[model samples]
Target chain A: MTATKEHVTIKGNKDGLVFLFNDHCEFPDLLSELQYKLEKSHQQILSGPTIDVHIKLGERELDVQQEEEIKKLVGHHGNLLIQSIESTPKEQIEKNIHQDLKIMNGIVRSGQSIHEDAPILFMGDVNPGGMISSNGDIYVMGALRGLAHAGKNGNKDAIIAASYMRPTQLRIANIVSRSPDESANEGAYMEFAYLDEDHMQVGKISELHKVRPVALQF
Target chain B: MGEAIVVTSGKGGVGKTTSSANIGTALAILGKKVCLVDTDIGLRNLDVVMGLENRIIYDLVDVIEENCRLAQALVKDKRFEELYFLPAAQTKDKDAVQPEDIKKIIESLKPDFDYIIIDCPAGIEGGFRNAVAGADRAIVVSTPEISSVRDADRVIGLLEGANIKNPKLIINRVRPNMMKSGDMMDIDEVCAILAIDLLGVVPDDQQVIKSGNIGEPTVMNPTSNAAVAYRNIARRILGDSVPLMNLDGKKGVFNKLKKIMGIG
Candidate 1:
């Protein structure tokens, strides 16, 4: 620590290492300290199996160039992959916007697909052979008799809901389930599918809040 | 001015050509000047279905390629003075006719006919696009089979995307018995899935196949139940209110009795 002001600190955990930079210090000073610390650290600490490195920029704003410089500096160290750069309010707002629920009107026809990183609310029917995939949850206001894949990239929290849940197939994260052959023509009611203990489960939509509270968070 | 209607189904053998032939013939029987255009290209069958294959001297490609005039290419129907058939070129592929060329051909034919029915080839390919390019309306044909309904849904979606709005649905080859037994999809289910206006439902008829074999449309057979369904569809197309034919087989005996008595 130079002059008792530690601008950068590196912590390791089971998941990966974390680079915490002090927001009080000037960005140039923090960058230099991070560079010096990585250079002086024991080779073994940087040379281990490839692991994620999360950079926490608490209350600090970084322009595009400064962020790139930080990434390059960390990448110079061995086996350290920059997984994410997390800042507070700005990043959170941007994330919320990206995860915003997108509404689409009209039917998804056979061989048609809608894939997105955000949650999707389709207002019309998803015909057989149609597909809808998302990294977040999927909500269909009309019949969903086609394929639906939610929580892509192993986001186990994602859910798939439909007004008429007679889906040909449902996929959540890494799990998949096909509808039963008989698919009783129960009067159209809202229903949903989610991953429970790594298994796929279907239930009435009213129980969604109790099952996945995050889904009700808007 | 004539209105061009494209009859299409995304899946093959769902009776696109058969519906085209029958609808065109029905329109002609209604005393409308009608022309049938076969846009199936190399796999042309509308001419054969209409029993005009023997008269296809100059095909659609000949007119578009300027080898012959449009009038020179159209073959007049033997039975109807107002009905004409434009056969597709058997040797050339779908790429032979461009969308612009079809639009121009339909525009030219519009002034001379009351209706121009274009038989679209199965599948959403260049041929389908070419057929739909000039149509002011569309008729999507589907059987009561799951595969046919799925394909019809796809074609209807494509038609709407192409700005051919409100495409009518024809549930062809319906088996009321199988539907009652829950073995086949019903007309209501098909209409719900496709979400389009119902044009007509032609029940499964052995005579349809026999008529095709003899190069005659079932719509020409007055006694055929499918023929009545086609005529009702034609009247509906003319903006005449026609009730849907009762598909319940229970009406068969009663109808036969009525016909035999001639209402006494």
Candidate 2:
């Protein structure tokens, strides 16, 4: 009932008792704090009957090992029934953002048009004159020598990445750009294209990690 | 069952009819019963290329429409006894027949012939669909030009979509001199763009044009360079691993002579 706990905090609601874990806290410290708080409150909270304990991890991805540790720590009291482990708003949004990714496994030949509402992962080459349009980001595992239009639904944050970026034309949001007359060196160097301000910018994939936005920091 | 192959090119004037005529004729001369079907409809040209235009008593539409028997519509070749030609309907358009009708006609001929070659019309329209409907295999033709190669790529995509696995490529009208001067694309360049197995390469030979004018396929003339290329392609079609012909023209001969003389 102490709200001053640094890493873990406990509260009661109409549904059940809720445990909130801070994402930035260390895992061992959080586990100890949870164990101490649950044991101290067990007698008072479980006086009537066993109540459901809903564990919420804010903005933190939980691995199986950490989840098992938390479950063991909470189950030590034997006076609570663990309802569910809920993710933070940030983690939930991240999961939902990538759930619509579509993966295709074939060459996109000339005159072929591919349309997608979500992100796309192509495992083959996009030959010249072929086109791909997506509302989300696009990632090509092979060469991209065609036209790629990302952020088709006005999402300025969408990006296009490819192993060999030699597209004839690239469009991000409302911006458009064409490939240069002379191509770069022919190698398996990965490249990416994204909208910077109002213009489309092309750069090496390694450089993208340095200047990514907060939402796409990972 | 006999294999039914379709020769197709999405763009016009890429030598689909000529390749079909030569390939069919060469196969027939090799003692295999071959029948060439012209599915170009109103733009029929295979009969003239095969030199059987005068002998066309009935057309493909007649056989499909049940106006004439299938055997009566087939024109016998004058040179090769095993070779036969089915002329297209010049008066009617591509709508004269459906894909199912062509499939049915090709199925009927499968038992009598060892190879049934279909000459598809240019463009990915109804005529092209009908020509490819009955084919178990496909051969895409292209030239060195960018437009032709682009169209060939589209046709290859369509063929793959139609479930014709591993369709072969034929680079026709290739000029070695132009390729050497960097004015035209080489066989390797075309193959790289198309990403398909190359069946053969036919050099731009005057003999092929002359043979076409005379209504005789160049494969009939053994001395012609194109004839040798066609024969090699036909051998490859019969599951023979024939090496590609050296179509580098005079430049390749000069290189060999320079190597013999040990001159820089």
Candidate 3:
């Protein structure tokens, strides 16, 4: 095969070494490529004390037999350990390239805190005195009665959405906003809070779907 | 196996010691041999509340440190023959005793007593963990105030995390008049917030203070409303389906009026 016909690529990452396989390649072709690459770098890779090899299957799910086959193939190469296998779907890999979404199911009680790197989907009520902070957006299926701090990493585009948005305190990025004098009326509809210019603004969830007309620049 | 129940309140002055003394006494009165273990250590108050402070020769630390036998530390109650109290050491702090130490102490006491009531200290620190470590069930005490209820919620979460499942709640110091006027949160509201089963509701009764001053739990005084509440709580703890006390204190009059008015 020519140098351009590369189907398997090996690279080092913060979490040990990773082996990437092209989705379009056949299983046999991918295995042969992996074997060839390992054979070439076997001396250098196997020199260290049992290093973990993270196998990244791009857009391809591995069955138990295929995983066992890959494990057997890697074992023949040397003392390298297969730490984990990451098989990413095409849609999810494309949508949340940088965002991590965590879905939690339970009530966030008083004095309890939940912190996440990316967005969070809470399936329960955030009670009074509870806190939830996220780097990206936060979606609560139940009442958001406690403190919610979204866009914690200074990403102002992050929004907080809840069925009942009567939060004790709502913070987006650097700006902080408390509940209004009279708490917002609780209804069947969902509410969203987002950063508008320098201040935080609360609106109906439907407002997010509406397209705002851009100001014409002469 | 004997049931070891820990009476805990995350916030102080919510009547954890009082509940322990009374519940242990009530259980003893119900013909069950009960021992109250005061695990507060430094700020020990269960012995004082149980009126056996002067009788404490060997405290809980003595039992764990092998300074004395477990039987030597148990002080017999003057009122109930079956009721006993294990006082906590006032000089030593919480770190003096580990959770495993408390577990071993309770395990030794298990065969002798029918119910081991542990009076847990306020706050979710080492002392609280030590108290709850040995207990099979837990009773969380909270007042009607927001601060007490909030702390109780936190304590409940910690209890569940510690694998103490389905801890019962006791809403103490509930003022019915304030509840009627919407000034204080009602029992139902507190129950809703905590999301725990209501074991009992002790109305704000002046008799509780009077009894505590004399080193007597109100559960001893049959006439006192708080005593009745504590007895009902004890019964519930025994798996009896006792209905919650009507805190309004006008259950009889209200029922009579409703009957006369043909509303009931």
Model 1: what TM-score? Answer: 0.78
B158: Cα error in model 1, Å: 2.0
Error of 3 at B230 (Å): 1.1
**iRMSD per prediction, in order:** 0.9, 0.8, 1.0
lDDT of 2 at A1: 33
Tens digits of per-residue lDDT, candidate 1, B37-77, equal 99999998887777888888999999999999999999999
Error of 1 at A144 (Å): 0.5
lDDT: worst 10-residue window of model 2 chain A: A209-218
Worst ten in a row by lDDT for model 3 chain A: A209-218
All models, DockQ values? 0.52, 0.53, 0.53
Clashes of each: 0, 0, 0
> What is each candidate's fraction of native interface contacts (fnat)?
0.71, 0.53, 0.59
**Candidate 2 lDDT, tens digit per residue, B116-185?**
9999999999999999999999999999998999899899889999999999999999888899887788
A1-218: candidate 1 lDDT, tens digit per residue: 54777888889887788888898888889988888788775456776689899999887888999999998998887688999998886667677765588878788888888898778988999889999998888999998988999988789988999998878889999898987776465434788998889999888999998898766323
Write the residue-wise lDDT of candidate 3 on A1-218 in tens digits.
56667888888888778988898879998988788777774458867677778988989988999999999998875668889899888888666643456778787888899998868888988878999989878889987888999989898878888988778899999999987675234333598888889688888888865522321100
After superposing candidate 1, which stretches have Cα over 4 Å from the reference?
A1-99, A182-188, B251-264
